[model samples]
Structure formats: C-alpha cells, structure tokens
Target: MELNPWAVAGLVLVALVTYYLGHHSSRSATSTHDFLVARRTVRSRRNAAAISGEYLSAASFLGVAGIVLKDGADATWYPIGFTAGYLALMLFVAAPLRRSGAYTLPDFVEMRLGSLGLRRFATAFAVFIGILYMVPQLQGAGLTLGEIVPGAPAWAGAVVVTVLVGANVMFGGMRAITLVQAFQYWLKLFAIAVPTFVLCMVFFAGGGPAGMRSLGAPAPPVFPKDTTVSVKTNVTVKVNTETYFYAYGEIDDGPARGAAHWSPAVPHKVASGTTLKFAAGTPVPVVSDIPATNDTWLHPASGKITDLLQTYSLIFALFLGTMGLPHVLVRFYTNPDGRSARRTTVHVLLLLGLFYLFPTMLGALARMYVPQLLVTGDTDAAVLMLPSALLPGLPGQLLGAIVAAGAFAAFLSSSSGLLMSVAGVVFTDLLPGRIRDFRVATVLVALCPLALTFLVRTEDLSLSIGITFALAASTFSPLLLLGIWWRKLSWPGAMAGMIAGGGSVLAALIYDTVCGYTGTVPPWWTVQPALISVPAAFLVTYVVSRLTRSGRPELVNDIMLRLHAPDPLGLVQDRVVARFGQVDDKARTGRGRHRKA
Candidate 1:
C-alpha cells in the first residue's frame, strides 16, 4: 500500500503554507497580548474553528476509528464521551472563565490568589500537561508520514512536524497559530468526509475495495432509543458440578490490535447459530469470558462496580480537564467580550459535533469493512488505510494524501498550541524579570519537548492523551473553577491547593508510568486525580483562607461585572478590534499598521 507521489506533494504543500503563515504573522508581534491572547480580537467563526482544530487531534481522527474497528460497540463511547464533555464545558466554564480576562491558567491564578508562588506552581503543572499531550501528536505525525511516504522513517515525520510546529510557534505566537488552525479545521473536515462518502458508496455497491469481501462486513451496532440492551447479563456456565458466571470478551493482555488473550473454556448452548441475535424479551446466550463488549465497559469478574466507577471517573476527568487545558482556556482570552466567548463556544459545539459525526461513522465502517485491522494491530491507522483500500490507484493515493495532510495538520496544529502555551508559561510565569531571559525561556521550552520525543514510544495515542487530561483535571481545573466563582480565595489557599492537588496527581502519574500500570488501570485510581484531589483542594483552600484571611477581596468587582455584563464597552472593544490580527483582511479593515496580537 505505497502512497502516490502526488499525495505526498499535497501534504508537503500544507506544511509549507502553514509554516509560512505562522512565520509571517509573528514578525511584528511585540506586546504581551500579541504573544499570548492575540489581542482578544478574533471573530466568532475563526475562533470556533481554531478551538475545534486544536481540540481534534490525530487521536480523535484515527485512534477513535481504530478502537471502534477492534472493540465493537464498546468503542462508541469515546466519541460520545468527548462531545458530551464539551457541553459540560459550555455550561460551566466557557463565558465566566473568559469574563475573567486572564491569558493562561497561571495569569488567572495570580489574579485570583494574588500569590506569585501559587501562580508559578500552576504554570509549572500546565507546562507538564502540555508536554505530555504534545508527545503523542508528534508520534501520530511520524506514523502518518511513514504510511504516506513509503520508505520514510517514523522519526523523519516526527522531525518534520516538530520543526514545522516550532516555526509556527516562534513566528506568530497565538495570533498566528489561531489563523492556521482555523483554516486547517475545514481542510480536515473535507479530507475525512470525502473519503468516507466514497468508501460508503463502494461498500454498498456490493464490491468493496480489494480484500474487503473476505473480511465479512457485519451490521453496525445500532443505538437504542430507549434502554433496550440490558445493563448487564449473568452468564451461567456449568463446569462439571460447579456453576460459574464469568465474564466473556476481556482483552486480558492489551489492545485488541492483534494481541491475544487467555480465557477459560466453557461449554454453552444456544438456540441459534454462531451469529448471535437478541430480540426484545428473549434470553440471549452469554459469552462469559470476554469483557467490554457492546460499548459497555464491564469487568466480568466484578459486579458492575468496576464499570460504574470507570464511567464516572472518565466523565469527571473530561469535565474538569476541559477547563484546565491551557490552550483551550487561552482562546477564551482572545474573544472581544464575554458574549463573543459564549458565541465562540456555541460555534465550537456545532463545528465539533458535525466533525465528530464523521469520525464515528468512519470507525463503524472500519469495524464492518476492515476487520483485519485486528491483524495489522495498529488501529490508529484505520482512518489512513481504509481510504486507500476503498479507492485504488490515483484516487486511493489522493485520498491517502488528503488523510495524511489532515493528520499532519492535527499533529502540527496541536503541537504548535502546546508549544506556545509552554513557552508563555516559561517566559511570562517562570522567568524572573528580564525580557532577554524570557526570550531564552521560550526557546528552552520548545526544545525540551522536542528532545523528549525520542525517548518514549507507544501505539496507544488516545490513552496517552487521556493521561495528560487526568493531570490537567487534577491540578488546574479545581483552582480555576473556584477562583472564578469565589471571592474569599487568597494566595495561601491557592498555593496550598496547587501543591496538594497538582503535586499529588503528578506523583501518581509518574508512579503509574514507572510501575508499568499500563492496560488502563482501575478507573477510580487511574482516570483523573480530580475526583479525589479536587475536593482535597477545596478543603485546603477553605482551611488556608480561614488561617490567613485577607481583609480585601482581589478583583471581585471586575470578575463579577465581567460575568454579568451584556458586552464589552464600545471603546474598549474598538481598541481590541484595532489591535486584533486577521489573515488577509488587515488592509481592507485599515488596521494594518497596528502590532499583531
């Protein structure tokens, strides 16, 4: 399945254009707003696109499809969970967080707590989470590059993406990257959708791509309007004189991407054939060995406790983590007003919902048409390979090229944002006082993550990303949410929470990684530290506030006024618009000479 040269050319073009745009935008940037928040001038449509572009990584595009391909209905929850989490974000964090008018989480921390020490701790944690998330994006790019260019080594792709990302980050900062991400989002949508439409037609035509027929396409799992599928079933197995009800379908070893697992042999009787079916009110035969089938994350050995805890833990991490992500939170500061922030979030949900629908469909299609992906053992490649299989020769290459371009866009856009976030923290939060030292810090931040990429290797891109989320959820989420709503929060409380919550999650993460607790450890202990740590932070904040009571509330009127106000003042908004950067529309608006933010 070597990719066509033309496809490679298309990918190269996207990289060059993206780099060019980023570099050109940053040349004139001078102020803190230019470096961090893009001057709070971005329009709703572009801002929403940038948010979606940064949020949807290679993991969502390829990793989710691969999971669905291998794990039947159980994998469907990943997309549903991802999209539903955003609704939580819109309701709880979006407008209010923006109303605070902080650039990074650290900026918000300093404003809320008025403690430089606490701000530094929060910033350091933000850097850690950003780097962790950036690694997988680099790896994904390398993999896609290898597939697209045949003889191209994985490291070559990683290097290419890293260099491009660094260039983008160094050039325009947030303002420049914002424009690149906005364009890339639409390109990604087309890249995935067109190939999917073509393949669906191919599959239904009774002649799928070559080798697709032998794999036996199955009917996709349908979502029941109501709770028709049982929450769980007791599989009674008779072994000699003993009756045991054990779970079936547990991937005991690792991911189902061609990995084998061990299970006890059991004899079962069914009224039907090998193809199992269950009608309403009918008793379905239970395969008591395999766990986590049908979008139900169950541990057969335990009664629903394990699955229930896993679900809640995952939900907790995603809900809180959305607020903590430095890149996402940073975008809120780019909007002109609280209303613009709200509008941008609504647009994000719409764009992401539309984009997410396509990926879920692709995953379902892979399950039916490309079941042998189980043999290849790289489910993340499902999105890339399926397009090639469906369209042969030029069309296949073109599709492959498009997918590669989008994958690279996902990798580079995300890497660029993370790098920018890390740079901002290092420069603005960590560096003592000198502007020269801050510039050096920016270079150091970018280079450190790029160097670390060589040491780690893994195929579980989605899981790696989830780990980063867990860390962010534990640390910054609690701090930000509380700081925004509460007036009593002081430097001591914020600092105590930072060390207690952030340090604990970091320690747990390091221990988990080193101890080889791989295969998604028990959900409660593994999902996100927020479930335990968030409450602990609240307790610490409460205690610390009482002990070191600050007579005056910091920024109380500003925060409250911003939250409840209809829109920004006309003059203030005009100043923001005058300073805001846009691609190709500067001259038309007669705002060209101003510095880019």
Candidate 2:
C-alpha cells in the first residue's frame, strides 16, 4: 500500500490537537479530585462517551473483524460478549463500584481489606493487569500504522502513540482522558461506519451472490494445499488423563496440505457429519470443517462442549473484567454523584452498541472481499486490508487515514486510562506512608508499560486481552464484588482470595510462557482460576473476619448509608447571617455602649 502525504498530514493534525487538549486541561487542576476523578463533575452523556471510547480498543476495531473474517459466525462471540459484559456492568457492578468512592480498585481493596499487605498485593496485581492490557493496544497501533506508512517500523508507531498517551495522562489525568476517549469513540465509529457502508454497496453492485460465487469459485475445495495446520485451541479437563484440543492450521506444501487424510480421522471428536477437503492448483492452504458450506469461512472446531467453553470464557471475561478495569472504574469517579454514574453506564451501553455494529459488518466484509489475507497469516489486519483493497484513488486513501487516526486514538485512550489507574494505585496505596512527587508517579507508571511493550510483542490481540482478563477476574473482580455486597467479607479473606486467585493465574501464565503450551491454553487456565480463586478469597475473608470480628455493624450501616444516600457528601457548610440578630451593629455605631444596659 502506498502512503498519501495528505492522509498522513491529517493524522498528524488530529494528534496535535488531541495532545493540546489533554495538556491544556491539566494546567489548572491542583487537587486530588482534579487529578484522579476530574473533580467528579462530568455529566452522564460525556462520561458515557468517554467510558465507551476507553473500552473499545484495537480488538473491537481490528481483532474482532479479523477473527470473524477468519472463523465465521463463531467469532460473533467477541461482540456479543463485549456488549453483554457492559450489561453485566450496569446491573451488578456499576453503582456499587462508584459508590465505594475509591480512586482505584486497589484503593478500594485497602479500604475494605484494611491491610497494607493486601493493598500492596492488589496494587501489584493491578500493575500486571494494566501492563498485560497495554501490550495489545500498542501492537494494534503498530499494525494500523504499518498499513498507512509503507516503510514505517512497528516500534516507531508504538513510540508515537505512547508519547501521545503519556502526555495526555501526565498533564490532565482523568479530565483530559475523558475528553479524548469521548471524542475518539465518535471518530472510531465514523471511520468504520463510512467504509463499511461503501464496501457493502460495492459488494452488492459487484455481484452480491453471483460475484461471491465467481470470486469464490477459484477458491479450491481447500484452496492452496493442506497440512496439519497447528491451530491454538481451547481445551477443558473432564478428567486428568484425557485432554482435548481442536483447530487445524494452514499446510503450505505437503500430502496433508495437498492430499486427503480421512483414515486417521479428526481428533477431539469432530462433529458427526463434518467433512474436510483439499482443492488442487490452489496457491495457498485452506483448512475448514463446515461440511455442507465447504467455505473456508467456518473452519473452526465444532462440538457442543468446545463451543460452550469458548462462549462461557468470553462471557465471563467480558462481564467480570469490566468492573475491574482501572480505566472504566475511574470514570465513575468523574461524575458529580451516584446518579451521574448510573446515567453514564446507561449512555455507555448505547455508544458501545452503536460502535460495535460497524466492526462486525467490516469483519463480514473482509471474509467476502479480502480472503487473500488468510494467505498472509494475519487475520488481525483485516480491518486495514479490506479498506485499501476495495477502494481505489482518494476514497481508499481517506478511509485509510481515518482508520490510522482512529487506531492511534484507541491505543492512546486505553493506554492513558490504564496508566492513570496504575499511577493512582502506586502513589496512594503502594506508598501510603509518604507523598511522592506527582509528576514522578505518573511518569514511573507510564514508562514501565512503554518499556514492556517493546520487550513483548505479538500479533495476537485476543491472546493479549485474555491474559489481562484472566488476571482481572482472579483479583479485582473477587475483591470488589465481595467488598461491596458481602458485609461479612473480612480483610483476611480479601487478601487470601487476591493472593490465591491472582497467584494461581500468574503461575499458569508463567507455565504457558515457559512451557510453550500452544493450545487455546484452555478455559481452565482462565475461568477455573477465577471460579476457584474468587471463592477462596470470600472464604478467607469470612474465616478471618470471624476470628477478628470487630462487631462494628454500625460502621457497615454508616458506610452503606453514605454510599446509597442522596446527599452531596455533606463535607462542606455554608455561612449565613441575619440582620435582626445584630447587636454588634449598634456597638459599631458607638451609640451601642449606651444600649448595653
């Protein structure tokens, strides 16, 4: 793809203005409220927009489309889980988390758990989750930039985005991020929606059903060749002895790649009627199991159990993890009161719905128009590839530019939010004894992830996301839910759950990394950790609370009343004067001395 100077120029202009707004907004902010929660003054609509913008990362824009393009209807789980997750947030997590009035999840932990040790553990967990989440955003930015600037390096793109994000977070904190993410959400929707509409027209005019068949005709029964494609699939433990795996990858040049192998049979108990085939003279390899359709679009493993695992894993992560997201949680504090927070969650759902519709459409378009991407082995690039391939001349260039800008925004918005959350935790909870330089705290947090991005790079945005989700589900989700709803929740149980749950997940992650276990890595590695760890946390808090019962039920009632009540926090008082009670006024006139009798 060729670079258009004008398009590049447009992107640069957006970047500059975004940075200016973020930097300028912070110059006046001096207090903790200004730095952490935008002084809790944002309205519902803006807060909602900012929340949606922050949550919709490169995965929503690019990874989901890419997954759908490569895997068909099964991939729809991405959007469904994402939207449904917010519903979960609105119902179970939103108001309670906001009402806690803690700056970060760790702060909430410290307050609820009442132990410096527990706070430190939660802080570390947060930093880990935040960094794990940051990597993919940086990678997504690099991928988008590489598409636009022909010769630009991935790290260069990463650097540009990191700097922009850091500057915004450093200067304005939550206030600046609110504006950026809110603006970015609309921009992202436009970038995807306009191109998607144009592509749909092209699809209909180009041949619709007929053109699809014609373009698809040359596609081999299994185009290219077939080999034992090494696909990373999720498996579960029904028992210890028997492990399950599914997913077949591309085989470039072999009998399996070219010839048929039915005798050996498909492993993992493929669907009863599933058929596998290979076409001749096809230049690339294709692997699919959708017997009737024979379209490469639906090649993923098929089974009731496997399907359930994937669905549940996605749902759990999406729903539970949203509450734990530092970025999302902090937004609640941006509102003036609980009502604004509740309203913000509602508006966020609407904005998220609007934006989600576009990416799903684009993913479908990519499957039809840009099947060639499967050959390049980068499905994640589908969002970028489809635009340039279909549109010629200026429209293509313009859309490409828009996408590039939007991608940068996604990275910047998400990164800034995560960095801000981490910074709050580090400064307040991690170093509670002393006040650190505010500037130093912000930079320290930002720099760590920026460094981590360079050290670990991946094309798999989904995998990166899963790592973060697993971490969040294990630690903060358990901590927050128990802390809020369960009055019996003891600080000991909170500490135990966070450590046990968080530690188990961390150990699994390490094993996955060191052992190179390249399966979907199993939902057990994900959901099991949360399911068990969360309970353990609750139990520990219970037992520990029983042992050291303060019996201060009134404290619990008081906190609840404050959180749920409709007062303006009642932390300030107004001065009043009455003219009728003014004997001092007569004394001031000097005739008052005579009136003292």
lDDT of 1 by residue, 285-304 (tens): 22332221332321122446
* Cα lDDT of model 2 by residue, 247-284, tens digit: 23322222222333332233322222222232332223
- Model 1 lDDT at residue 27: 65
TM-scores of the candidates are: 0.78, 0.79
Clashes of each: 17, 11
In terms of TM-score, the best-performing candidate is 2
Residue 371, model 1, lDDT = 39
Candidate lDDT values, in order: 0.64, 0.63
The residue-level lDDT of candidate 1 at 593 comes to 30
